[model samples]
Target: MIAPRFTAALACGLALAGPASAGTSLVIDAASGAVLSSENAAQPWHPASTTKMMTAYLALKAVREGRIGLETAIPASKLAASQPRVKVYIKAGQEVTLDNALRIMMVKSANDISYVIAEGVGGNVENFVAMMNAEAARLGMRDSHFTNPNGWHDPDQQVSARDLAILAMALMREFPDYSDYWNTGAVQLGKQLLLNTNGLVGRYPGVGGMKTGFVCASGFNVVATATRNGRTLIAVVLGALSGTERTVKAAQLLDDGFSKWGGGYTLASLPSQGGRAQSICGDVRRKGGGVALADDADSSGPIAAQAQDIGGNASDGGRFATAAAPTQFSSSVLTRLPSGKISLGPRAEMTPVPVAFGRTPGSASAPLAANVTGEADSRVARGNAPVIAPSAPVAAGLFGTQTGGLYADRGRTASGNGAIPGSTTAFAPADSASTQPGESSGPMRLQGAVRSGAAAPASLRAGAAAGIKPMPRPAARPLLVKPSPKAEPAKAGAASRKPAQAAAKPQAAKPQARPKTKPDDDA
Candidate 1:
């Protein structure tokens, strides 16, 4: 059968993004290749920024095919720098290192940087994009296309939630270093430090690096990843309305995926009612691979590990290539991984409960859905993990805030404080230096004069003094917390009373002892 096409991808995507459907979400075990939880997994829709996954895929392939190197420099032409929003603002003639440019584009989601790199690697924007389409076809990205490197918007640029999940896995497998940037919390470019748009990077448990995309037509789209035990899973949520909504939705999907113990069925149980279950190539039980999960070893309720009679179909993207693909600029050169730190394990396992299969197709309990697709093969293995089912609703809201206005206000506050309280705290979580004005939040205390040219009280002052004027002195935290009014009298008395006051007139002048007068010095 012919593979799905780009135009059909957009039409099919729009058709799938119904109000009732909200498009489908999938949480697949990257290791076992098992479907943990699926909601409308077949729907199609505009890919938004997640389309960059295809872009990254092709770029990595070029690296694999001998075309570009991470250190290769690309010039920003008038056309390349014209795009706006989330940019490092490279001027037309300025040269940006390919490695740094991608760090800006992937970590910061810079539209202009993408164009610059596309041209830098392919010699021109259009030709680089042609490479993107060519690579997508080669990878069997049936429901995808690229008119622009930065997913600004076009009926022509489209991908399905399922295809996106597959694409994400491919990128992770192909370009480990480049993919690691997706998890980067922020980027540093001269005067400006751009933060990652993916909220799941530091907030939700197990979630790592991935990309975020938005457009009026696509709402919000995110290709999210998480790791627990040794297993890593990818979730694709398309057409979400807000960043918070996207993370929460993605987290919910991850929870469902990690919740399964993937307990093994007896060899007989695996065969199913009639024929041998279509074998996925990399299921953990397969020859050399196994799925990884954290915590539960034996089982988590009834795992959705039941086998199916698929017609032996497998993902077109091949198994994890044992060796890293060759780089474009040179075979010997390998791009160094970007440095960034962030992670929180998936939430502690909830009480073990039965997984509901009513809404799910091919669940452990329900007969595999009638509409089940073809047979598949994968290399996956068993690992301990907490159980959460996707069919259930996720109760928590996502982190990150609205764009501009309150968002900018929050960023100013969170960065100042050092810790972004995320969506939960009263005062946005801030770094300690933010608590003291004119100081940074993270680490590395300023050796210079702090506020009033005085020393910072504690060593906690770590971060930038960028926006603050002269900075403020670190005030005692007690002052910020309301002090009791009644204690004022006691505190004042203690300050005023002299050390001599505590001594009586010696009850009398004992032997008329002469006492030395101590000088009163406030300085």
Candidate 2:
């Protein structure tokens, strides 16, 4: 039922003055499913990584039903390894616990981990998707349909802003105990400190849990839930031009819900405001590089796959806008939000949750930790935990395990920018380059082996002594400089005349006999 206050506002000509030009925005009360305000709430749009919300809901449901356990070990199958970056880079046969996988998928928006979760929880991708669609229908997400586990672009897969609110509400209400999975601000996986893709997580005071998503086709989208004064609200913003816009808009929606707005109607009652956003990549590419190029490699969660131009440039600012620049938000976007200010203050210091590869310790099925030692690579410890390499045998197995696996160090000089492991180059999210001001600059390059200047492990030295050859240095490519034309006029004229004579006569020259050389000449 539509709330009286909302009806009064609309009747008083407070309906949004124009069509929702900035994609869609919907604000709703978490407790009642009553929508406080909305624009284009019923319009179908791509969910992007926000699709992971449904993926998480279903996975948690499986856990509650004993179909899967949080500690269950799942392998990154060949299919998972083949997924593009904004991933944990889990290769086939490598493993992570279900708990850590969920945390990484939510915080880093890792596509491959989503695939592992789908396979672990639902038995396979196809079956998992069927389960997703079934759950959407059950939850009354009438405008939502999922075709893959990660929200990769699929023309056929889409969800309305209202549908997403429904999904978010369902996740929070049904699985309140597991809200940490979505609410977490950062994840420490081995040495990589992966900040949550949703910039609002630590910055927004009441920002509890939810997800952010993007694809050129979808623009920047987020389903953010926050609480203040005991009232929880969910905001869905889709098709924002940049991550800054997405964060600011969602923040404004939540702020309004907490203060001035009262419920007007149930989310289902909102009528469709028809129109679709022009693809950000299409617009940027057409403009010859106006905005940050969307990460063409980002697949929404593992729940949907759409064949679209998913490849493009990285983001403008990293995923979250650094607090250093308050000007990142455009005035055009600021005008749409209730408070015309960018409320994203400095990022809050989050105690990152640790997530490690392979199964949890002590499980009967867990692989035994090998005993070989030296400093483990920085990436072996979860979160900001102390760096500890896996035992030598396990470390050897993990580094460069796949054709393009975790090891990016093949020909990398002491500086981090080295040749990537495989024949194909990896595409990281635009923001992957700079998540925060002081954090690692190159999120895509995971550090393998010892840090620069560190002594090699004794085992490694012994291996070299035992005749194992280290990677050969890549040869420097020779530059070919064309010889300058001779200064002699006679030679120039002769060269030109020869070309003309050859064209006119088509004569074949006799082969010259091989010249004999003295020992000195040969040497």
Candidate 3:
């Protein structure tokens, strides 16, 4: 099988990660299928980049069915190599086996790999996507539909965290052989050390395998799995702040869940919490971070493939207001019900945010998600990708009117110049002022927030016109005069920026040193 020299035949890369605009977050115990904790678990949302979870699910099904084997090699054709954004640097016509494809696709969350796998498996992405939908239907994911392989911006594609949890659980049981792929820490693909994006894989106790996702529409989301005392638990935390928050929240949830359930876990206990009466769906709706852009905006970070609560107050001081911020999201059975209606979780004085997800576009400058890792990433793990509904929302009997995989609250009102939530209030906008493309009317600018320090074209944030007070840019470092470029190191793999042969120009460019291979459909 054709395997990259750097990446072990085991697992591969990271994917985007972010949440919706509003404040939202959720946690669930996969084995029991319970909604342990949540903010707006039922609200419609943009599935962002988490859509890759579904893509991986479909591909894994093929792997398990013997249609494609781990050792089976497929080439990264020009078409696949041409995919934009996230990718593994595979040259055109360079053969990559099914196993390595999954590794790179999962760990790196390479869009290019997705395109190649789609074509190799179904002759084309359109056809492979058909298989994805078929599998979704078979899995009883009636509320879901897939429009792309990598979970980029496609309003038509979506999924809810609940449904995502279902898929995560299914993968755990249906394909035990592939489970090890998720737990991979990093792949030593030649000189490059491709690290796993999931923070807890090797850092946290009991954390096993899983995935994370993000995009422009969705926020940071992770299907976090952990095992403690022989009791395995998969905690899916959708739409968080940054990479660190996603894993930390998942770990906290697992800690709480294992502390209480360990051997006593059950489906009935899925809707666990710290101290509140959660609804059938969950507790407080799960959410990402909030950005104080120029306008009244919600979570404006990079939304993953599958991926809010909107909050704010503008009248506190002149036109300046504040927004609701996200809290530490975690999963655990209710410790003691707070004395209240429990419509929302208890509001303590934490970091207040205007939107649910991260800082709005003007302030949200980091990458919301990382790439996928392992032989197969999860489908629902696609991070936040903004979802703009059509004038006529798509409807069907199986999914119900106003029903889709995930949901976003498009009706939340906001105030101008809001800070973090708590003291914020909604106010009307000045009629003469118009919104800029990247800036929201909320306190934060909603136009250009992205994780990984990447960004959308400036054109996307052009709609808003008011000069948004941009987030404090990172401190500028004095540029030191660079030394003249030296001879490049010779050990880098095909993934490096410099040419592979430039560093170690072997006598005449030839494949004499190429590693021998035996098909590893089972790797």
Candidate 4:
């Protein structure tokens, strides 16, 4: 059952806020939660992928509360695997560690992994969404509701800029230890460089972390956090015309907040506005803006070479690769504030947090969704991961040892000593990275062989894997039977007149010898 407070809040919001606004923006003092600036901040609008910030917060809360562990295993259900693009594309039944799933969900803004996380935390998506609503009400998010894990479009799923600032602050205040998850600019997944969707990370000075969201209805949105001279600020911008616009707008708000100290209304005291964004899907310029929250993780060319570096193929590279310059170019937007400090440019490069599948190497508890074969304990004990295959499951001991790609430098055990054990399995080491303290750092013995950037070679490509599977050939169609035409009734005088005419008809000519070749053959 939904929380009564949440239900009441939803009813009140719907009754009072008739429609959302075209856009909303807010800036606040992170330490005090004091509102610095706001524009339509109380207007409800779609959250888009920025919804993942709340999801990340809940997962961290669960970990802190011991409801789940960082090493807990979560399986990607059919529902998760079937979610739309901007995902890691883990196949149904494939498992990921909670630590890695959160990193992927935050940095990559993966929709599918969000579902996997929802299941891991709340046992399923429905329960998790309920938890989200309850949490929102408890946090005093007066104009917010969540219907899905990844913030996919739903008319009912809405959040105000003020509420977004509140949520961002909650994540910071409650889980300061897990701050690395949101701030990291990228995470190397085997051969792929998964950069954060928020382009301000490495580019804008003092920009620490946060998340970005986008869809046609929501335009583009971001909840960004930054620190400078002992001052930290949270900026929320919603429903911009493009990705760059949203980033720039957030930067401008942050700059203004920094330039001018706060004397404005607090979040709770802000006036409530009734409206929603006018649908922008029909705008050709908005559609063609070509900015998306989802990055092309599988594209070849320069990104492929970068993946090779993360896979330990680059001469100057090591087990893990840091976030490098963006592969594509973006226009820089200058700040309009008096301080002239923060500006929106290309995504800044920084060292990424490492993530992998399976439990942390030395953890005591078994994965939440361990193998059904009752071999999870033995397999994890021996450092063997489940191998992913396109056709069918393979026998145990066939998957190779995980590489010392990017990982936390936990003291290596014999199995963790970067040596492959005696086995007939053919597997490649996955991506590795240096991790923040308390994150999963030991190398994973992932099941299935994944090349750089490619999760399951055949099953995890973004556009290719998320499409409808091929159908079996339809049965041969039955031949149609044409009914015989009914005989026409004879005219009154025809029966008598036909006998003489038929008798007098000239004899039919004799058939000539058939030609050797068919008549139409030459023609």
- lDDT (tens digit, per residue) of candidate 2 on 1-523: 3455644443333223233334666777654444565665666787777888888888776654444556566767899777755566776887666767887898778888888888877667898899999877666666788988888777777887877887785565434435556765555565565667776665565566578887666777888876554445788888765566567667666665555333333444443333442344554233325444332111122111111111011111011111122333321222322343444454544444445676544333322111112244421222342222222211121111122211112221211111011111111111354332322222221112334344322221110011212221122112111123544322222232213221232112222222331111100
Supply candidate 2's per-residue lDDT for 205: 59
- Cα deviation of 232, candidate 1, in Å: 0.8
Q: Write one digit per residue (lDDT tens) for candidate 1, span 1-523.
A: 1234533432343344334224445666542334454443444466656766666655554444334444344557787667755455566766554445655677667677777767655657688778887765554445566788787766666666556665674554334324434554443333343456676554554455678876555555688876654345677776443344555556555654455532221001111011111111132112112321111111212111111111110121111111121112110111212231111222212111011001211112211111122232111111222231221100010111211110011111111211121221111223454332321123121121123323223221111111111112112111111114544322322222123221212111012111221111000
Q: TM-scores for all candidates?
A: 0.49, 0.58, 0.49, 0.58
lDDT of 3 by residue, 1-523 (tens): 1123312211111001122343244454433333344443333344544566677666665543334444444556687777765555556765555545665566546677777777656657788788888766655454467887876656666665545665675555434335434544443333343444565543444455567665534455677766543344556665454444455455555555444322221222122111111121111122222321110011222211111221111111101112222332233211222331111121111111100111122222222111212233331223443332221111111112211121110111111101111111111121225432222132111111122233222221111111211111122111111122352322212222112112322221111221221111000
- Residue 445 lDDT in model 1? 16
The TM-score, computed over Cα atoms with residue i paired to residue i, of candidate 3 is 0.49
Candidate 2: residue 279 Cα off by (Å)? 4.0
- Per-candidate Cα lDDT values, in order, are 0.41, 0.51, 0.39, 0.51
Task: List the candidate 4 regions with Cα displacement exceeding 4 Å.
Answer: 1-21, 274-278, 283-346, 363-523
Give the alpha carbon lDDT tens digit for every residue of 1-523 in model 4: 2245543543353344323334556776654344566555677778888889889878876664445666666777899988876666677876677767887888888888899999888878888999999877766677788999898888788888877877785565434435556665565454345666776665556665678887777777789876544456788877665555566556555655665344422344443445543544434133444333322211211111111000111111111212222222222334223343223444322333334444444234633532223443432223333332231111111122221122111111111111111111111222345221221223122122122334321221111111112111112111111112442212211222223221232222222232322111100
CA RMSD (A), model 2: 23.4
Displacement of residue 300 (Cα, Å) in model 4 is 17
